[model samples]
Target: MSVAKLVDRENQENGGKDWIVEEFLAFSDDNRFDCSDVLFPQPYFELSNAFVSQDNKVSLKHLHKFLKKWYKDLAGVPWHDTHKADGGYYRYWSFEAACSVILLEINDDKELYDYLYYPKDLIAFYHSFNPTAGEENLLNKYNRIAIKAGEKAPQSGYWFTVASNNSRQYFNAGEILPEIKKQDWGEVYWQFEKEE
Candidate 1:
């Protein structure tokens, strides 16, 4: 079954809560829905709209209670991304057999809810695209060069030059420009030129 349908079915089984149910769907909606790589007997999936309610708080408590009952050695996942818990979002994480479970809720209504499993094999995908400050510094220097070239030419294509080996290497800046704007070194690395 499709993940959305699976989620909707699970929601029905757990007593549906109000939200944009048909609007936004599962993260893997575009791909296959398999139980082997993820947690089975799927949990609740929601999108919190920041609607505050004592009932919602009770719901959050129940979700946590369920997780505690199921998993062991529960610990908070140290996330760097901006998540406003005080604004009414809560997060919980736990692990077993190199697979991790993440439970998240946003606002009192629990605007965004996700129960995701991070398998050991998938860690490389995240590592490939998470940027570092040192990489950002390097990009900044190259960005300046790219922007200067863009200003001078005012063309529709890459017109940048990198000084190297007493020579210049002309590279297409189109691919890397967006990563530069976002200051994302991981993307830059992913698209970096590979030696033949």
Candidate 2:
């Protein structure tokens, strides 16, 4: 009935070693990423985001494969690839970005949106979407907002798709983001107009 209870039941079924599900449970508790039982897609988003956020050390290829296996049918093929913002035009999304999309697409719940879009959380999630080293997109884009906010960037580049070497433009843009308040970064994050 409850997500925690459901997760506990899953843990029991897996002999307490279901790392993916366990990670999701841990994330849910840590981030307060909870939702009402009536919200079906919330569980899916929570589970996927938690799984993706668990380890930034994983290879981007593996991340793509995992997403494809679980999400391809509903979200489509592009959801399995790196986002256009990350220099790949395959319609992919980072874990947090995807969670943002899910909240909007699934229910448009502003409270949940604010929770997921908090600056600290956004920066962390952006970092978690790190790409593997030597991914040849030529023009890899890191989130300046994350770096400027004092969060650590992943050691490896956070990219998944390989674009043409000739058309690449490795520029460090997305800088000059809105200055958010310390206590209510989410409010600022929500109100800040994204410059495209």
Candidate 3:
């Protein structure tokens, strides 16, 4: 019924979070990755400004893959690959950037990579939709596109498709954002405008 319960079930069915770490670690059961104590390391979690988009859908599998790579690559050692801005759950783009990185690592989908990793091309298209010329030409190019955060959006905006609602650009962008305030952040996130 709830996401946490679902995650717990997924873990039980598959393996505990730490157990998942054990497999990727260089250390075996004898000298496993010092992953016994995890700090829920500061990540770009978007629990606050995270609106259940009609387009983007996250599942247990998504969480599994995201943390699997994040812990292995980030927590495996002392150094991590993230920023303080990413820690702000209320901040929009930070979370998206984090998600983009995670998805990049796990999925490595060429097209998705281009969309999330490189926002320059996407921005060009978005702007072009206004008749503003771009570096390339292809009318329906702006259709069915999603940009996480990087070069295009100053902060981190998302471009989504909603058959009837038309394309949407989320102003707040964070993948692993955590809440700064109470449950208010969730509702507050909607007040902001979806800039194009």
**Ten-residue segment with the worst summed lDDT in candidate 1?**
187-196
Over the stretch 1-196, how does candidate 1's per-residue lDDT look in tens digits? 3445446563445213323232233332434222212123223221122122335555455445444343332223344222544443343332321121122222332221233432323333433466689988777655432232222322234332332222222344343332223333222212122122
In candidate 1, stretches whose alpha carbon ends up further than 4 angstroms from where it belongs are 1-39, 42-55, 72-170, 173-189, 192-196
Tens digits of per-residue lDDT, candidate 2, 35-70, equal: 333222422444444344424333233333434444
lDDT of 3 by residue, 128-167 (tens): 4554356234444533233222223334445443222433
Q: Flag the better candidate by lDDT, 2 or 3.
A: 2
- For each candidate in turn, the TM-score is 0.22, 0.22, 0.17
Which of the two candidates, 1 or 2, achieves a greater lDDT against the reference? Answer: 2
Please name the candidate that would achieve the greatest lDDT relative to the true structure. Answer: 2
lDDT, model 1, position 93: 36
- lDDT, each prediction: 0.33, 0.36, 0.34
Off by over 4 Å in 2: 10-17, 29-59, 71-196
